[model samples]
Target chain A: MSAHAHSEDDHGSEGHDFAHPMSVQTLLAVFFALTFLTVITVAQASFDFGAFEVATVMFIATIKAVLVMAFFMHMIADKPFNAIIFIGSFVFVGLFVIFTLGDSMMTSGSFEPVVEELAPAVAEPMEVKVDGAP
Target chain B: MSTIEASPEVGHDDHGHDHDHDHPAFLAHHFDTPEQQFDSGKLGIWLFLVTEVLFFSGMFCAYAIFRALRPEVFEGCSQFLNTKLGAINTGVLLFSSLTMAWAVRCSQLEQHKGLVGTLAATLSCAMIFLGVKSIEYSHKWGMGLLPAGLFAYDPSNPHPTDHPNYLMYICIPFAIALAGVLLWLVVSAGLGNKMHVAMAMPLTVVCLCFFVGVGLGMVLESGDETAEHIDVHADPNGLASAPVMLEAEKAAAAEAAPAIAASGAMVSVDESVLEILAGDASNTGVTSGLNALEQQNAAAGTSTITGDEAVVGAITTTEIDVMTPTTAGVFFSIYYCMTGIHAIHILAGIGVLVWLLVRAVRLDFNRQYFGPVDYVGLYWHLVDLIWIYLFPLLYLIR
Candidate 1:
């Protein structure tokens, strides 16, 4: 297709079929949805859900990311290749988190004694570390 | 097409590859079609975003490790963070992302005016985020809520033993100022005339020496003074029972919290206990150490000292010593690492957006070709996406 096949922009283009890709209405709607979800994130923070806190907050954030990618960023309408490239990053990030968490939980109790070791260092008098033993 | 070709100032990139004059000027000579060019750029940006995610994932890993290892400290530290400000920053970035998205759409539809306006708005919002961040940082620094190494001055920590030696009251500000100057000197040397590097090099050494010399003097002098009082109590092997003595003092002071609150009217402090609060002000040049505590207490009003005569007792006579290390510092280290790296991306986004804005004014992007705007929009959105996770992790974690 010619690059300027339907490039009658800003004026005299009303009758052209699907001349503009995205509508102002959709952008505004996505904007409002994003703002609403932000409010939800803040509100949910005040409550105690025990084990659900991290999962719930992260889930909400994922929804927010999806909205951003799908509508506002127009990733929904992008070519499958571009969409894959974007979504692929998140997939890898997810895997990274999963692997790290899995490994850490496998040896969880090993870190329990770390607190006792760290707490005493503060009570000791300040000695400049780099200037010593030379 | 003829009009577009005549405007080749829209950043023409061609390495011995030439496009026909009919092609839009922004198109590279190497690409057969504008669609192909846009596709290539978009793919490159997506890959860059991938690297960004991987880059930030390291910090996230650090955050996860620490949060898992020490949830209680993380919770205690989170309480110090102002949620309202974090929420405000989140709102600002969200709105900026909206504007950024709108800008991309504006470029695609050939609304040059809207494009410029949205880009400007996005830049302003980025600036606003940074401004709020700097304010939060300064407040933390002033209160001594620093990361591990700089943990010297928190007047707000409640327990005086949590604060580092009082000598840092002078050292922190002086050292920070000198370090700032040294940074400025280094930046100037790098950016300015190359001929002056010889002089600048020596000056850098002088600044370094002055910093080390003054810091060493203060530490040694203060170390001597601390030895006279608390040194005998500290075991040279570091396993010594000085902490036991500290524990006893903390308990006694904790009990006196109420007595000090009532002291203005009906209470009087024993001279020995008074020494803890006042820190021997008669020692020349040492103003009352209680000033930070008093100010904090006055602000906190925890003692309900309703009258000027009501003196909150010196609950802590911890005359300046290095505080015991707390895992809370790890939380801040991750905080700075994550947010600091993110802020750098925001600054970079602003730079790219500004470039696009200037080009937009030049009528570089329109319905036929808005690849740069689209590319930057994607990058900015990724920055926003990172913040979406960062907000909950660093600030809103329950």
Candidate 2:
């Protein structure tokens, strides 16, 4: 629970300060996965995804982003609270995006048909009175 | 209490030694341990990546809306963009990401020589990526691909009436590619071993940032011009069928109705009231004249209001007028904004990378302490991912 607990890794007398966190194999595997994802993204773009085009591209990109975050970023091995912080930021941004989309959809254009239909039913007597006066 | 455990002689310096002095090589002061330090760095990068995704979502949203509104126009614009260049840039970025990952591994394993070499390799690939992007950008520029009024100076080269050349779409693609390359270089070489590469890293980063700033500044300003043009078109001059006389009549009616309606109880007015009423009728006469002129123009088929013809074509000519002695289009506006923002982010990424590189070079990192390098690499990769989508959306959507 102490902040100084993580500082234990900084106490070498040799003056060397850098520490390697990942193995060569892990690096190689991540490299291949990233490349594979890139290929897949480009390949997928060529097809007619129509309304799903951006969504599909973004979905694949999200996978690639996750891979980079997990392995290359060392997120997979990090503290649970760190992961929580990362996910929390994502959740906040996600909520912002979803709320914006929902609001935009809901407020789009006007539903004036109901008003139009009810106007005649409610105002017919008034219209007759006005016309008769004229 | 346990005799099985080995007991050491504690009569000497052991009595005065600090337990805290036995810390490992990788931990920073703020973290609980090397693991936690690494964890926090990784967390920071992930959070940063989320912001990036959100930032890029704006462009994707623009692309989606425009595509929905004018799929045919977008598709037509896409046909002019080069897919091959996009694919190549995608390949280059993917490779650079690989070398960046390798550089982190080399640092982790205490392979200083290998780390330096891999960092150099990653840097080289990044430069190559930039070089390729430059070539693509130059081609777009040379071919009048830049946005309207942003140095697209080929007046003699008028676009054919039937098919306007929307080469500016390629601008965003090349800019994204360029930003990707710069971001990679920053991660691998910019932040490797700081002490040895200190001067090199910062200087390279500053220079790259300057270039990116200038390039993107041009892009943003170019977009501003297009927006200005759109605003101009949206103003009074925008609609070709604005009824001047009818507007005058409506103004007069609005003024008179308030006064006359207020005096409804006193219907029997003097000659002054009659004169006022006659003046209002005369204004309506002017409106009728305007209507007659509109009808005459319609009968002659000289008016620009052809119902069957596409509105985009007429808007294109108006855009040309706005961009005349320049270029114009919403596509141009989007192109400049997307590429411009991406470039700025790349410059920032490069600054971090170079700083890490300087540290790596000075033996500041070891087998037990390279979390910064790995996290920097993660940030760099996310920058590249944005370009992957941007390139096709701008250039190869066809």
Candidate 3:
């Protein structure tokens, strides 16, 4: 479908007016929701979650971000193609993070001591022994 | 407030695009359909947020690595931080989010005054937030308790002054000064009624003085140490490690001087040492007087000092011991980098909040057009979230 054809406002053969795209109520709802989520995530940080602490916090943050995108941003009513584009972006980020972290974690002990070759006999060096009378 | 405005009806010439053709007043004309426009906006927001996540990820990575390597150091450092301030700031930011939402609501309702009011409220909250944060940061600054790299402490080391963080010594004072000025401006402007102004002036002066005193004292002390550690040793063989060895020897001398003085040996005691020892002796003497009989019995029971008690005394005198520089070095590095980066992000986020405030005051956003407000609000929340972790990780870990 053409981009314009998906517009709900133009499809008024039944004479139904296009509803307000983003109402104040929805915005307020989202605002409170996001604020609450932030608070919860912060509160959760005080507990000793050990290994799950960072992960749990991040999971909640992702949920909050998604909510902001969907409701306050009107993503649900938007064309499906936009979602595809966003998912594509995520794929790239995922690949980048995974590969980089993977490398760091896996090859940690592979760092060999880097040895530099002596300057190609630029000058003769004199060595002195510990005991004096050379 | 700029006069430049884009007509929402442009670039639709191919279909004889006219305003009469079901043109939704809210829809901008770049998209082929409203759905496309909405999707594009959402997609753009996601990408932006992703970049933000990645940007913040760098700080988190630093935090994770340091926390893993020196958990005790992080815990010890965190114990000094005030989590209450962090929690209060979190609440303040959350309140600002509410105001931002209300402002957007006003925009949708076409209530310009309400929009302005809500935005003003949000701005006030942001200002309040920054104010509280300043107080917290300055408290740390004044105490000479900044992270290891900046105001390093080696309570276990005798000559902590000798191992002063030259870099933090140089940088943190200016940052504190700048933050102080900005904070003063915000308070004077945001909360500056006649009454608030009356209350603020003295507070500002006092805070400014406190800030300056701490900064000057730290820099002066650090400068003295740096000067003393200056290497002038002439090595005939030009050994590479000569300066390092020289510095080490100097540190050792600084360390040994105290013990020698304590034992009434050959070392000369500085006024500071005499003062500290005098204080400790008096304090301990008072405590011993309270339990004289027990102390006499203990002294009679064991002629030699107990290992644990000696160790406790040693630990108490760590700031005087220059022996274990490793612990100080390890912990200091972690503390400075984590807290320093966190503070910078807080400053940047505050800047963004200020910009958003200006836009809100201009009545640039309404209920139907509050995307920017929402976006910035999300960013603010993320900043707050990071601090929540940082507070515990740095200040209250133990």
Candidate 4:
């Protein structure tokens, strides 16, 4: 029965109706790779990478995500249109993060005035209350 | 959703409506062939997955914005998160992804038994992840590490005396579900129904996995706490000394200062003496206040001093703890938001996986009708993919 199913799979592969059955070996390999990357990311956290810490961690994570997308998710065998739209979502996410992050960075200076004006107002009352309490 | 519910009756009803096309029972009336139906469903699921990606992107955006803005807060709060549990959960979700993908493959190859096993394994992993997560959440809540409005974490005495036993509350639902599954197993065995027995057996194991997760979480959390305790006591010059001094100051504030101050012995206090005193003071409670003062004098190994001068000295030399609510609470808010929504997705994934499991048990899937399993597999993988990012972002923060 298994041999017959394999033959059918082969025959169907010539047409467009075949199911993409990923080999067990490939699945295990991807799992091991992901696990290894997880360990590496954890170990990397113990080190002080200075300014590149976030970038380094995110880089390893992106690699793991791509491995998951390509192999476990079978994006390699999936229709190009599906993969395209899925990856396109990330493009939009990038734009969203960049725009919002950039805007916040650009306007962060504007917060200084409010914070400075409120600091004395908040501090003076707290000091007065503390002195008056005793 | 209706398409995913392609039970035999639904398939037969569709067949009765379209006798001309002679398609498989699983194929809908609108599709020309099983392949067309499969492709259409696949496309639809991918589109849904894209929306899921974008939906979670908003939280990631919030995380990035906040982390970039207050890197220090992220640094401080991330320390409270147990890295070991995060790594374990990452491995669990990744393994579940493997099982899910294998289930999809098994369905494609018409391996019903293997499909059932893989689906069960995937569900169990999800349960374990939630179990560990509940431990993480409750432990934080016990420490008063809540969101901005509710944050009351005291650095000096993190484990408050009155915190609720959150683990017991978390275990109640799992315990009930386990009992229910066990009852089903017994009744099915007594009735001598082989099918019900088989289903009940795996359901029983899956239910037990939740407790296994809870047990695992409790053991690891306690182990972490013990390690932290030893770490504090092992180092005299460690930052642990500061919290000890703060504890002493707190003890003195409880009305023991003036009476001891009237004795008027001004002995200088060192870090080690203060640490020893604070350690005893914190453990002995308010009633042990005088005893702790006597121990402080002995531990000082010098001329005895009154408690008032010691308390004043400790207060004047207090170290600043930056892990206050206003600073660290915002990080926890994002932490809870991102991981909370992700856990909800895992829960939703479990619901759908159970649906797939039922269908798989009925042998409703074949080479051409395996779209449901495949779609759910895709969703499960996307959930894991999000965790792949979340593990590092939240746990592996530098």
- B1-398, model 3: which lDDT tens digit per residue? 11222434453443333433433444475544434344356456666756665665555554554444334434434433454455555566556655665554465465766765565566556555545544444434443444322443322222223333443453465457556755765676786554434333333443343344334433433232222222111123434554454355344443534333233222122223332232212222212222222232344543221111122221222223211223333344445555566556655655665555555555566443555655555455455545545544444333
lDDT of each: 0.59, 0.49, 0.45, 0.70
Please report the TM-score between candidate 4 and the true structure: 0.75
Q: After superposition, how far is residue B57 of candidate 4 from its true place, in Å?
A: 0.9
Which segments of candidate 3 are over 4 A away from where they belong?
A1-7, A11-134, B1-42, B154-371, B374-398
Candidate 4, CAPRI quality class derived from DockQ: acceptable
Candidate 1, B220-269: lDDT as tens digits? 32232332123312226432544454455444443445444343422222
DockQ: the better of candidates 3 and 4? 4
Ranking according to lDDT, highest score first = 4, 1, 2, 3
Every model's TM-score on chain B: 0.56, 0.54, 0.51, 0.74
Q: What are the TM-scores, per candidate, against the unseen true structure?
A: 0.62, 0.55, 0.50, 0.75
Candidate 3 per-residue C-alpha lDDT over A5-111 given as tens digits, one digit per residue, 9 for 90 to 100 = 33555553223332234565776677677668756765775566766765776677677657655654445755566556554656765665555545545544211
lDDT of 4 by residue, B1-398 (tens): 12433335445445344433334467675664566577788889999998999999888887777667556556546657878789989999999999999999999989999999999999999999999998788777876777754666654455554666676787798889889989988998999987777777787888889878877876775455442332322334544555554554545543444454443344443322333233322222222334344545555655433212113222111111224444455667778888999999999998898778878888899887799999999999999999999999898764
lDDT of 3 at B397: 38
Candidate 2 chain B: 10-residue stretch with minimal lDDT: B318-327
Query: For all the predictions, what are the DockQ values?
Result: 0.22, 0.14, 0.07, 0.29
Better of 1 and 3 by lDDT: 1
In candidate 3 chain B, what residue range of length 10 has the lowest lDDT sum? B305-314
